[model samples]
Target: SGKVRAIVDDKGQQLKEAGPSMPVEVLGLGGVPSAGDNLTVVENEQRAREVAKYRQELATEKRTALAPTNFDTMFNTLSSNVIEFPVVVKADVQGSVEAIVNALHNLSNDDIKVRVLNGGVGAITESDVLLAGGSKAPIIGFNVRPNAKARELLKRDNVRMMYYDVIYHLTDAIAKEMIGELGPERIEHVVGRAQVKEVFKSGKRDKAAGLLVEEGVIRKGLFARLTRADVIVSATKIASLRRFKDDVDEVRAGLECGVVLEDTNDIKPGDQLEVFSVEERERTL
Candidate 1:
């Protein structure tokens, strides 16, 4: 709650009161008002305090409702494959905070996700530093500086601090960080395709398939998938390749060879085997 000390016209003349659409300056605000906030004159100071307390309670309830509380839910996050990068954000204005938070959220993908613990306008405070310290999350400030108490706590707790004035730089840096955490990307390339002509018993408990190389080339010890009616049955590797009881390393297109797949026994004639290899490449955002 704040008291109106004086209302002055644009020419520095004191005014008894001001009306809508009048050019005047209002003095004695308790806090810096955010853009689009309503300036309403309440009945009394006590009523203003009551409204402020109620709004504070509502904000607290919203925060508590968004937080994870159950043990199962907490443990699930710890055991998940997706990596989470938590951060606290502070900006010079509310609009800047919203833009930064939205940009960070948009960078999330299947491999990694960004979690903003808290976002607020104005300078970073001690409470924000404490929250970041508790969560082990870094603090990102956009066109805003931390207070002396917050700086002291950040140094004492060894928290990471990032300051940026440009929005794109902040987003690009975060994307690169996520890519680094996820490591390289794997790409699969199909090397060969072969159709099974016959299935016969190779040993007492093992079965082998006679494959006719339909395209490319099939090599022994390469990864392959067994497909029936265009549906994948199992993924197996070529254990052995033979032609007329003679061991062969590979068979080119338009050739017939017997192949024993490792750890797979569901072999059938007229099935298809797709041979492929994997390559690792640097990941990008």
Candidate 2:
């Protein structure tokens, strides 16, 4: 006779027969079998239950061993408002790191200030956390994450790690910690727009652009964005914004002016310029 399996119900009564070649649809009955029904092939269902119960008990005991131990709790003696906030900053890109570092540094004051222990561009690594641990600084990341080992170390050491997707939010949160009150939300408001009408060559090394202010007022020393068609070409600071042959502070909408972009001279006609400024309230958290 070929091998076969007897299907049993919760009452331990045979319901049907199944082929042994396919194995039983279920193994080791647990608790009370119900109407949905399960077919088990084990000859000793009681023994399987014993093993599962032992594993569950072991797991519970292990969990009980891992008690609370975070960095915040370990460093309860650290004083507040008496020292500068030492921070280690990391981001996905160099420009982002620079921007975030600058924003954080701008939040320092007489009462409490920001002191960046270190700054870098990359996924936060184990070494970074170790560095921060030595310096007793909190690690702040922008558009990045801690590596596997770093995460483990942070949990084990109770190191503070804060991550954010937006630079504005990241800066605001850190600012509030230093200022002791939640300040205003930072906003980027557009100031002016200009269309490049022509490119001018001044010297072998110097170059400038002739622009027509299309909207708002284009001011000197403001940040600018150069766009071609509908795509962004560059985002840089205005080295010099001039009108006529002399340097002027600003030009109103619909006026023609000259612009010198820092570190770039590939200005061309049909390029659009956008100027914006960062505005915010005066509070902190």
Candidate 3:
């Protein structure tokens, strides 16, 4: 019988069946195979080459399809002003990892967002550290931590590692960090406007300007902007607001008022005054 230890063609081979010598032509896969195991019964050398070629083609196509294109994503990200905290997640349990990732992905907005770079179940390893470093992302591991080698690399690369024993703490810390990164958006609102009717000197060089409230009411302690022909000449606060020598809370339009800018008396007749204040809005990711 021909040796079957190595891959061999069944055609033109000798076999002993029922103690009778015969030339084997029929092929049979003699052993059971599992799902991923290949059972190749080639009839000749040419057939083996054809099978090898087909597998190579499949591998090449798969590689081409899976390769990533990140240039455009990166360019747009760099140009825009969005707070994106790129993060890599690891956990000890599959369920924990899935739950944490789901919770994180739900937090989103146009100005701020969390970009998960990679995620998996397992203790944090050296490969995880390397991937985080390459992506400029921090590693967040839940109920897990880095190995000795991974810790060394993390220190050398100056990568931030945040590990938490409790799942709530992990999510909370990340949320806080995202909020901090989001910061606050500033909205400038113009409250009122006035024109300096006359400049009157009061204390030493300090002068209180007689004003006519042109648009909105100018209130006491409101921020004041002294402008000449749309150019900001001075920015100050309303130190004193009065009418007819009596301190008043506010003066309405078409009313003559006395307005004193805090710590400044640089008032000139015909200068436009814009009363405005900047308000902050808390943003989220």
CA lDDT of every candidate: 0.87, 0.74, 0.76
Model 1 scores worst on lDDT over the 10 consecutive residues at 59-68
Clashing residue pairs in candidate 3 (N, C-alpha, C atoms within 3 angstroms)? none
Clash number for each model: 0, 9, 0
Ranking by TM-score: 1, 3, 2
lDDT score, candidate 1: 0.87
RMSD of 3: 11.7
| Candidate 2 TM-score versus the reference | 0.39
RMSD vs true structure, all candidates:
5.9, 19.5, 11.7
C-alpha lDDT of residue 57 in model 3: 56
Question: Which parts of model 2 have CA positions greater than 4 angstroms off?
Answer: 1-186, 280-285
Query: Per-residue lDDT tens digits of candidate 3, residues 192-271?
Result: 89999899888887899999999888988878789988888888988889999899998888898998898776779999
Off by over 4 Å in 1: 1-9, 12-24, 27-31, 40-87, 93-118, 126-137, 147-160, 181-183, 200-206
Deviation (Å) of 47 in candidate 3: 26
Where does candidate 2 have its weakest 10-residue lDDT segment? Answer: 25-34
Please report how far candidate 2 places residue 58 from its true position, in Å.
9.5
Q: Model 3 scores what on Cα lDDT?
A: 0.76
Between candidates 2 and 3, which one is better according to lDDT? 3
